[model samples]
Structure formats: C-alpha cells, structure tokens
Target chain A: MDLTLDRIRLAYPDGDGVLVAVDDVTLTVPSGTTTALLGPSGAGKSSLLAVAGAPLDAPDDAAGAPRAARGPRRRARRAADRAAALRRERIGIVFQQPQLVASLTVLEQLELMSHLRGRPAASRRAHALALLDAVGVADRADRRPEHLSGGQRQRVAIARALMNDPQVLLVDEPTSALDHERGVQVVELVVRLARELDAAALLVTHDEATLDPVAARVHLADGRLVEAPAAV
Target chain B: MFLALRDLRHARGRFALMITVVALITFLVAFLAALTAGLGRASTSAVTELPVDRLAFAPPAEGASPTFTESEVTPHQQEAWADVPGVGAAEPLGVATVRASGESTAAVTAFGVRPGSGLVPGTGDGGADVSAGTVVLSRGAADALGADVGDQVGAGPLDLTVAAVADAEADFAHTPVVWVSLDDWQAVGARGDAAAGDAQDGPTATVVALRFGDDPPTADALAATDAELGTVTATPREARSAISSFTAENLSLTLMQVFLLAISALVVGAFFTVWTIQRAGDVAVLRALGASTRYLLRDAIGQAGVVLGVGVGLGTALAAGAGLLAARVMPVVVDVSTTLVPAVVLVALGGLGAVLAVTRVARVDPHAALAAR
Candidate 1:
C-alpha cells in the first residue's frame, strides 16, 4: 500500500463536549490505483481524507490503535513534528474549489509545487509546461486563475497536483461545483492521471455519479467505515 | 519574496496606500529632527564657538546654577586661574547686549576681548582691526545693523568705528554678537550699569575664559579649582544651560521629537497588524504547502522592507529639499545628524513595527487551510 490509515480517529471540540468526526476508520490505496471514499454530508469523508493526506500522532484519549507517523522536514528517519514537508515533497492535494492562488498564473501554480521545495523555477519550467499540456491547459499557461473558467481551473489544478510526481494524491470533492458532464470529465482526468503517474489516489466525495471510473470504492457512514474498500 | 512580490503587484492599491502612510510618517519624523538640531544650534552656537576649554563664572547664590546673567568674574579670579597648573590662557570675556546704529538701528550682543585675545571674530587672521573705539560686527550682527566696514555706529552715547564686518555667526539668547575692545566695553558698561549706582573703576567682565595647554583638568580638579577661586567652572556645552530660555525650549522640543518617533513605530506596527490579518488565509495556505515559518516570515518582512525603503527614501529626499529652501529664512540645518540619523531611525523603528505584526505568521495553524470555508 502506498497509503494506509490504521484505525484513525479524529475529534473536534463541540459545545462542552467532543464530537468524533472519524471513528476507527482503516483504509488503504495501492499504487497506480484510484479509490473513492463515498458518504453523505457530515459523514467525515473529508476528515478521513485529511488524515490520509497528512497523518498525525494519535491523541492520548484516542482508541488504542497503532498510528502511522509522518516524518519531519529536516530529519527523514524521525517521525514528523509536522506534515508540512511530507505534503510538499510527496503528497499532492486537489482542493474542492481549485484553490488556485489569485496572484499566480496557471503555469506558475504548477511551478509553485517545485518552488515550495526550494527548487528554482527555471529548473522546473519545462516539466511544468509538459504537465499543463497533459492536462490540456497548456494554451492557458500564462493566464491567471481569475481569467480561467471553472472547468479550466479544475484542469489546471489537476495538472498542478502531478507537477512534483507525487507518490500519493488526496482530492476533495473536485466535482461538487461542476455539472454532470464536467464532473465526469474531472473524475476521469484524476483516474487517468493517477495511473499515468503510478500514484495512490484517494477521492473524497458524496456524489454517486462520479464513482464509475474509480478502481476501488470504500463506503463510509457517520465517521465509520461501513464496508471494506471493494476493488473492481 | 516569490509570493510577497506577487502579492504586492496584485494588491497594488492597498500596498500603495500603506507606503504613502509610511512616507508621510517618515517625512514628519525627519523634518522634526532637522528642526530640533537647527533650534539647538541657534540656541547654543554663541557659547560653543568660543575658542576656550572652560568658562569660569563667579560662584552663584547658594542653590542656583552658574549663569552669565548673574556672574561677575573679577580681576582677582582671572589672576588666580592664571596661577593654576596647566592653565594655558586666562582672559576676561565681557558679554552684554546693546543697540547698534548703522544705516539702521538694531539690537546686538557685544563681546569684550583685549587686543590679540584671538577670541574676537577675524582677529586670528588679521581680518578684524580692533581699536579702542572700533567694533567688529559678526555677519548676523552686520546684517541686522545694516552696517559695513568703516561705518560709524552709535552704541549708546558712544560713537564707534566698524573696523571690519567679520564673517562669523554667534547668537546669544537670539541676539547676534559684535566684538569690541575691553576699554570701550568698560566705558560702555560704566554708563550702562551707572543706573544702579555700582559702576566703579573695577573688573566688570561677565566670565573668565580658560584654555588648558596640556592635560585638561579632571572633574575633581575642576571642582577643587572652583572652590579655590570662588567661581563655578563648566565646559562650553555645559554653559549652554545658562542661557535663559535654552534649557526649557531644548527639553520641550527634544521630548516632542521622541514622542513623534514612538508614534511612528506604533503607526507602522498597527498598519502591518491589519495587513497580516488580511493575509492570514494566504499564510495558512502557504504553510500547508510546506513553507517553513522562517520562509513565510521572510516573505512578509521582505514586503515590509520594500515599502519602508521606498517610503523613507522618498520622504528623506523631500525633507532635505525642504530644509535647503527653509534655510534661507529660517534656522534649518541639513546635516547627517539632522537628516541621515533620522532616516535610519525611522526605517529601523518602522521595521520593528512590521516584525511585530508578521510574527503572527508562525502561530497560524496549517490545518485551518484545509478546513471547509
């Protein structure tokens, strides 16, 4: 498994009590495969995805399950004091709303992935341009996000996620804002790109229409895994 | 600077307004510093320009500080100072303000010095020819009196010759100085002080000017000498306090400048506080993308540096130009102490404010960026 979640639990503060968002949920995604986490609103699908994207040290009160420790930036062998370095070098994220920086152009957005890791932009421009071409937005490389359409922005985001050739991809409701056709197209793009890059991909969403292209489907209900992830 | 520069370009309007505020604050601070120095020079230049190491004043009343107004150094005190070890030159310096008549009449401070005393303006270079009945007017005094060299000027019932118009500026209590011989000075003083019925044949100089040839007197020696001669001795800088209005005015203006500096720091800090809060979302996003706390701080502070550099640089240029123009009609000096020191201080203080505001970047949780917003 390129990614694993071993009985992870997450909670947020409620009015004088704790509200468990994710309860002992374990899941995995093998490399070169796309897995879909399907659930309704408030079912902790996003919460689970966040955990898989960047695992944390289990709290003292959490259920006695083994926690996966992410490594810190400076020391590779030591467990991460934070997930910042892990996210920068190995994990790519596709946020629900594209989340492209307003100041950066589409191409620069992809280049920023390398820049975040202290790589010079000149050293990554060719690869960034190729990623844009693969996502079919090479023509819009110089245009800012404000100038792009919703579909175009999503495409740019997908290209950005693959810029650093990440080992794991965490995408959250990328199609919630699109219509059926554009939504299917984004899903197909993610699935194809995951296979092309040979990376483990987790897609978190409640929409049932976008599940056909996913190679594995995991059912979640009320912050708990309802059934084991069924691979097609 | 990657994201910082882009943010500046994208939010040009907001950043420009911030820069303008910084510029205005810098201008106020720099201009005030120049004015403070200018006023200080105007207040103390007369005493400071005297070519002597120490000034000896007759011991004051029990609790009062030494002052030229109440000081009355006698010939005995002058002779005693000359007898002390390391005392190079001791001379009587009589100071008094009286009216001068040239093409027009004007008020002037008269400085009484003997022949070849070298305390009079232009005497060191043979420029001023001081005679018993001739006076050498400083540049300011000459301008005020409207008198030139060789003109006959009436100085209170005594017609005196203007030996030479010396290019020197010494203003005592806002009055310019005119150098005159000691004989003419006493002759002028006997009539001037005759109203009190204490005008007699005596040494009437206000203070004794001292110059130490080798090692100057230590604080202990100065105090011992003061005790022995029955006089108060102080350096020229210390004597500035003796000018009636100088201490009060200098203290008040210096305090105001200090307050202005503090206010400038607060203004910059407040501005950056708001700016950082507005960009907190961006900061979180960057943090989530693996940017270190150090990187984010560098970006924020780099942005501030750009703003402060341009704003302060421009404001300093404006103040310097204004100071030059104001010098024609006012006592405005444009020097390193007046201009560059203020500029450096403003930038440093403004940077401090910016740092205070942006340090919040370190505390922002990267998890907030992933939260559903």
Candidate 2:
C-alpha cells in the first residue's frame, strides 16, 4: 500500500497565533520503497511523519484520515479510535529512542505487535525469532534493551516495526544516539527491510549522509517540502 | 495482561510492598471486626439469646431510648401484655447486678423469675424447681463464685442455697447470671415491705419477657399494644441497645473499621496515582502503538486486583490464626462475616481507588511518545 499525504496541514498552538508544522504538504511513498524525510531541527519533518502515521483530525485524505466527519465531539473521538487502529494494524512506528518497554526482552518487543492486536505473542514466536535473525540480533533476543548496544537496539526496533508486516513504516531519527558508522548501518537495514517487506517506509532524519541506501529523498524546511539532490 | 504481568514481575519489590500494605490493612479490619463481634456477644448474650421473642419495659420519657438500667415493669403490666392479641406467654423477669459470696466473692446479675415460669435456660423441660430460698446458677456464675450445686451463696440481704448449676452460660452487662425465685428476689431487693402490709402497692421486676405464638403481631399492632399498656416493646435482638455499654462499644469499633477501610482505599489510590504518573510516558507509547483506552485500564486494574487478592488473602489468613490464639485469652469470634466480608470490601474499595488513579491513562496523549522522553 502507498502512503499518501494529500495537501496535509498540521498546526500547533503558539503564543497567540498558530504555528504550522506541516504547511499544506503533499507527499507520497509508493510500496516497496524508502523515502527519507530530511530536514534540520524544527523543520517539521518529525511532525509531518507523525501526521502520516496518525493524523490529528485532518480533513484531507491524508494517511489515517478521520473516520467520523459529522459531530465534533463524537467525530474527534471516533477519528482517534480509527487512527489508533490504523496505526496498530497497518502502520508500524519506530521512535528515536527505540521506545522499548523496559520490562520486555528484545524478542518480546517484536512480539508485542501481535499482542497489541489482541493475538497471542506465543503464536508469533517463530516469526518474531525469524525477524530477529533477519535483523542480525537473534543472539540477543532474550536480552533487555539496556543490555543491547545502540545499533542492536535500533535493529530490534526496526524488526519490531515490521512484525505485523505493516504496509507503512514510520521511523523518526532512529540513529540519533548512534555513532556515524552505526547510524549508516541502521539506516541501510531500514531501507533493506522496506524493500523486503514491500512497505512504504518514511524515515525522518537530519543526517543526509545516511541516504546512500534510501531510494528517494525529500527535504523539509520551515514546514514546507523542498527539492533534494539525488541519492548516491 | 501481557504488559501488566510483566510490569508486576519486573517491579516485584514495589508490588510486594503494596501487597503488604493491603494485607496489613485487611488484617486490622478483619481482626477488629471479630473482636467487635466477640465483645458484643459478651455484653448482650443474656438478653439476646433469651427464650422469649420480646421484652416489655416501662416506657421511657418521650424522645428517649429505652434502658434496662431504668426500666421497671410491674405485675399489672405483665398481665396487660398477656392480654394483647397474638400473645402466648408473658412472664415477669427482674434483673439486678449484685455482689455474691460463696467459696469466693464475685459480681453476678440475679435474674428473678416466678416458679414454673420456664424462663431459666434449663427450664424448657417443665421449668426448674426454684423455691424462695434456692437459685439456679448459670455455668458462668458457678465459675465466678467457685460454687457448686448445694453450695450456699449470699447475695444482697439474703443467704441462698444453689439448687442446681445450669449447663448454659449466660451474661448480663458483662456479669454472670443467677436465676432465683421472684419472692426471694423481692425480699432480697427490700421490696418485702409490700408483703409485710406496708403502703407500697405491689412488687416490680426489671422487664416482662413476652413469648409469642407462631402468628406474631405486626409492628403496628405491637406499637398499638405498647401504647395501650404504657410500655415499650422490642425484640430480644433489638433490645440489646438497652444494655448501655453495647451501643457505645459497638459504635466505636465499627467506626474504627470504617475509617481503616477508607484509609486503605486512599493509600491504594495514592500508590496507583503515583505509579500511573510515573508510567505516563509508557502509556503514551502503548496508545501510539494501538492499545485502546479500555485495554490499558483493564490491564492496570487487573494489576491492582492481583495485588489486593494476594494481600487480602494473606491478611485474612493471618487474622484468623491470630484471632484463634486471641480467643484463648479474650473474646474473638473468627467467622465468615468478620474475615471474608472485610476482605471483599477491602478489594472493592481498593479497586475503586486504583480505577480512579489509572483513569489518567485515558488522558495521556499518544503524541507525547514522539518526543525524546
């Protein structure tokens, strides 16, 4: 499935007026491709990615559009419920810090996707183990996130994001805490996983050097998309 | 419960502490309940376990509750109650606490009943042959005076022989009871002036014990009869309040139990509130990952249930054991109402507190998970 952000507009409350984080932006990431959202700090790349993952009451047919469109109270609630279900079943989110539950092991982190969808985690053990093997972290499956290295944790997060075979994978600064070499390797793994899973992956990162493995790139500045140089 | 179970196991120390707190509170409540019931039995068993269904007392001043300490019923009042519809037998019963000397000196409540009145505990079999100078001693009264059947005991102004020591135990106002003839009681009470042809009208007793037929009078009918007879009537159980110490003692203990329950609920709520706040970030992440509000609430409340279950179970067991041991030295009735009821109430109130605390789960913004924290 393709991830389309059609004329998306995201705003937040400022001192007196609204600060538009994503200004009528339209973007698409076709299936089986990695589209890197490159931008500096406060460029609204993370905001746009968040909107794509689960848009907040958006009128346009953005990714995860509002389901209810009539009554304000019920509509907002229904929309949030719909968006959460969308994120659970179809969209896998990978945050900057791995966002792993401290009590869960690396293997259970991936299996959580199945559990969140109300399925038994044991039923998906083989698949979870296979994903860990694919991510080259099978040896560390039973270890908590604190015991794993930064790159390994990021790999685990990526594997977890793919646990449900999501059509859209949204990742935000997954390599911020890693060194230069480890950061490139993590991004490369994300790109490879996207291709293998046929997921429309939108990765948010300010480090343009890690775009070697990503197929397409789009830059955002001042909450508006700009043309980017071709990937290596 | 996937996350909830793991959370509990991961933080066993914290959860254990919480369980201990719940258990201690449950223990206090359960033990207090048992003690309260036991003390209540000691204070009012004689009046409550009476063979008669009701008792009639000289009506108190308007707006005042009846009291055995002040009630004085005459033979005329007993005759009036016997005439009321649905009445079976109305017997005059006099109650007086006095010091008696047998092998030892002890305080005993002297119960005065007419010969063949069938009011004594063992009198169900055509009544004990209690004569004017003889008394039937309850087992408690026997124990206190260290006296046996055929032993002579001095009570009030009369010296009486123990005709028989009744097998049943009865107490009135925390003192053992001794049954005696009504004539002997009146003589010991210095009401013999009437028998001596003095100006006093007649003899009097504390209250009239009224036994009813199978088809008893309704409340309204009883009230009407009471008004006509110039007396107040109450069922034996209801008459317990007339024992001055019972009402105050029961109220104080019950209030303690109620306050402890409230404290346990507040403590559980406060613990859960702080816990939910600490895990607000994790909750946001889960919401973002598609866990519904209802699901999270269920998980958190289930966690509280586990803690309360283990705690209350352990506490009740502890209380039962302690209560049994305490029963050896003091009155402590360990039973279902004292143990299980308090435990269930604790879990319910504690769960309420936890539910209120974890409601913050619904308000946690999923967008917060996007930030570094």
Candidate 3:
C-alpha cells in the first residue's frame, strides 16, 4: 500500500466531553488505484478522508488497540510534523466547491501550487501546462474562475490538485455539484487521472451512482466503515 | 505577495478607496504639522533667536507664577546676574508690546539691549549700528508697519529712525519685533502718555538675558541667585510658555494635531479590521493548503502597505505642492520635516493599524476549510 491509515481515530468536542468522528478506522489503498468512500452526510466519511490526507491529526490512543506509546506532547509534535510533511510531500486535495481564488487564472492557479512548494514557477510552466492539458482545460488556461462554468472550474481544480504530482489524492465530493452525466464524467476523469499519474485516489462521495467506476468501494455509517463485499 | 498583488488588481476599487483615505489623512496630518511648526516659530522666534543661552526674570509674588508680561528684572538684578560665578554675560533686555507707525500702524514688541551687547540686531561683523534714537525692525515688523531702512517711525513718545531692517526674524507675544537701544526702550517705556507707565518704583527691564561658558551655574546656584536677586531663570526654550499668546495658540493647535493623528490610526485600524474579516474564509482555505500563518500575515500586511504607500505618497505630494503655493500668501513651510516626516508617520501608523487588524489571520482555523470535506 502506498498510502495507509493504521487504525486512526479522531474526535471533536461535544457538550463537555468529546464525540468520536472516526473510530478505529484502518484503511489502505495501493498506488494507481481508486477507492470510493460511500456514505450519507455526517457518516464520518469526510473525517476519514481528512485523517487519510493528514489534514486532521489522528487521536493519540485507539481504546487499547496496540499502538506505539510515547509522551502526549511528543506524540502531538510528531503528528504535527507528519501532517506538515504529508501536505508538502505526499497529498493533494480537491475541495467540494471549486474553491478557486477569484483573482487567479486557471493556469496561474496550478502554477501557484509549484510556487508554494518553493519551485520557480517559470521552470514548472511546462509541467503545469501538461497537467491542465490532461484535465482537458488547457485551452481555458487564461480564464478566471468566474469565467469558467461549474464543470470547467472543477476540472481546473482537479488539475491544480495534481500539479505537484502528489502520491495520494483526496477528493471531497468532486461530483456533488455536477449534473448526472457531468457527474459521471468527473468520476471517470478522477479514476483515469489516478491511473495515469500512478497515485492512490480517495474519492468521498454521497451519490452512490457515481461509485461504479471506482475499483474499491467502502461504505461509512456513523463514523465506522462497513465491511467490504466479499469477492464472488 | 502573489495573492496580494492579484487581489489588488481584482479589487482595484476597494483598494483605491482605502488609498484615498490614507492619502487624505496624510495630507491633513502633514498640513497640521506644518502649520503648528510655523505658528510656533512665529510665537517664539524672538527668544529662540537670542544669542544668550538663558534669560532671568523677576520671580512672581505670592499666588502668581512668573510671566513675561508681569515679571521684571531690575538694574540691580542684572548687575547681580553679571557678577555671579561662571556667568559670562548678563545683559538687561526690556520687552514690551507697543504700536508703531510708518505707512500704517501695527502692534510690535520692542526688544531693548545695551550698546555693544551683540544681542541687538545688525551688531555682528560689518553690521550697521543701531544706536540711541534709531531702531532695527525684523522683516515681519517691517512688513507689518510698511517701513523701510532710514524711515522714521513713531514708537510711543520716541520718534525713531529705522536705521536698518534686521535679517533675522524675532517675534514675541505673536507680534513682530523691533530692536532698539536700552535707552530708547526706557524712553519709550517712560512716555508719560497712557500707553507708557509713569511708575518709577517698577523694575527697569523685563528680563536679563544670560550667557554661560564653562562650569555653568547649577539649579541650586540659580535658585540662590533667584532668592537673592528676586528673579527667575529659565532656558530660552523653556521661556516660550512665558509669552502669553504662545501657550494658548500652541496648545490648541497641538491638541488638534494629536487628535487628528489618533483618528487616523483608528480609521486605518477600522478599515483593515473589516477587510480582514471579509477575507477570513480565504485565509482558512489558504491555511488548509499548508500556507503558514506567517505567510498569510505577510500577504495581508503587504497588501495594506501597498495601499498606504501609494495613498500617503499622493497625499504628501499634493500637500507639498499646495504648501509651496500657500507660502507666498500664508505662513506655510514645505520642507522634509513638514512633508516627508508626516508621510512616513502616516504609513508607519497606518501599517500598525493594519497589523492589528490582520492578526486575525493567525487564529483562523484550517478546520473550517474541512467543512467542505
């Protein structure tokens, strides 16, 4: 497995105590494969994605599950360092909304990812252009987010997420805002891009119809992953 | 500043509005500072221009403080000051406000110094003499009375000839000054008319100007001298408040300037506060994308600095141009202290306000961006 979440747990404040968002959730996906997390809203699917992407720090202990023991402060610092490294080296994200900055053009948006990674943007222009071409929005490189349609904007965002050639792609509801046909196309694009780029893709989706193209599907209910269907 | 520059380009109208506010505030601050400096110069130039380092006036009586209008240094007090140890020179200076007439009548403060005192105007190397029965007027006094060199002007009972106009400006009590011999000032002060007092018991001169070399007298020495001679001594700069008009005029103008500066800071703070709050969502998204808190802060402050710089630059330029034009008709100075200093202050203060406002970026949670997950 290229990306793994080893029995991760996450919690948020509820009243006085903490409420579990993801409980003992262990998952793994190999390179060049796509996995779809299917669940209704508030089923801890996004929490699972967040943990896998290292956006949320996993809980310190897993309720007596065998784990490495360390001081709380040391563990927290390690987790923080891991998250930072994950963001810089391994992970890419597609937010549910287009989440495009209003001022940046489509090409500039992708270029910014390279800039943030401390690469000279001019040096990475060809790579950025190629990624945009792969996402089928190379012709609209100069257009601002407002000028692009919803589907085109989503494509631009996907291209942006892959700009750094990340090893793991965490997408949040990429097709939620698209029509049925457009939604299917977006899912297929995610699967194809995952294969072409040799990246492990985690697609979180509420629409079950869009899960057919993904190689593996894991359903989530109330912060717990349901068992995968047995092979026939 | 990638996002900063792009945001400016995208929201030119809002940034332009902010810049205009900054520019106008800077202009007002610079103008007020110039006017304050100009007015202060007009009020205290006479004492400040005195060659001596200190002035000694008669200490006020019970329940009163020392004042140029009320305090007087007698001949005995001047002699005592001159004889004090470490004192270099002590010259009696009689200051009194009186009306002078050439082509027109105007209020003037006549400064009385002895012959060869060098404190008198036009007494330096190769300078023309201002003996008894003759006076030297400052440029302001000359302008006010419309008098020229060799013109005879009536100063109270003494009809004196204006021997020469002094190049140095000296004003007291918000009135232009005329330099005359001590005898002439006494003659003017003793004029038997209602404007001049006939009381012989009063002190001869208003104050004694003092100069000291090595081992200047300590405060205790000065206090002992004050007790013995019945006089009060002060540095020339400190003596400015003794002028009645200077205190009131400077206080009002300085207060207004301070208030304006405070308002400028508050205005910048308020504007940036709203701007930061409006961009909180963007800040959250950026943070979630691994943008450090420091990066976001730099971007926001850079945005603010750009607005402040352009705005303050424009406003300062406008003020300097207007000040130059106004110098001919009004008392306005357009120098670096008057122009550049205020612009720098505006940018610094406005930047401070911006920093305060945009610190909210540090507290924005990257978790909020996860809501879309």
Give the top-scoring candidate (lDDT).
2
Residue range with the least summed lDDT across 10 consecutive positions in model 3 chain A: A57-66
Candidate 3's C-alpha runs over 4 A off are A16-18, A57-85, A228-232, B62-65, B190-202, B218-220
Predictions in order: lDDT: 0.81, 0.86, 0.81
Better of 2 and 3 by lDDT: 2
Q: Residue B221 error for model 1, in Å?
A: 0.8
- Compare the candidates by TM-score and give the number of the best one: 2
Model 2 C-alpha lDDT versus the unseen true structure: 0.86
For all candidates, state DockQ relative to the true structure.
Answer: 0.33, 0.44, 0.30
Worst 10 contiguous positions by lDDT, candidate 2 chain B: B190-199
Candidate closest to the true structure, highest DockQ:
2
- Residues A74-159 of candidate 1: C-alpha lDDT, one tens digit per residue: 23212222577787788888877787888888888887878778887657999999988887899999999999999999999888
Reference contacts recovered by each candidate, as fractions?
0.35, 0.53, 0.26
- Which ranges of candidate 1 are over 4 A from the true structure? A55-81, A228-232, B187-203
User: Candidate 1 or 2, higher lDDT?
Assistant: 2
Query: Which residue ranges in model 2 land beyond 4 Å of their true spot?
Result: A55-75, A229-232, B125-129, B188-203
Compared with the true structure, model 1 gives a TM-score of 0.91
lDDT of 2 by residue, B20-61 (tens): 999999999999999998998888888988889899988888
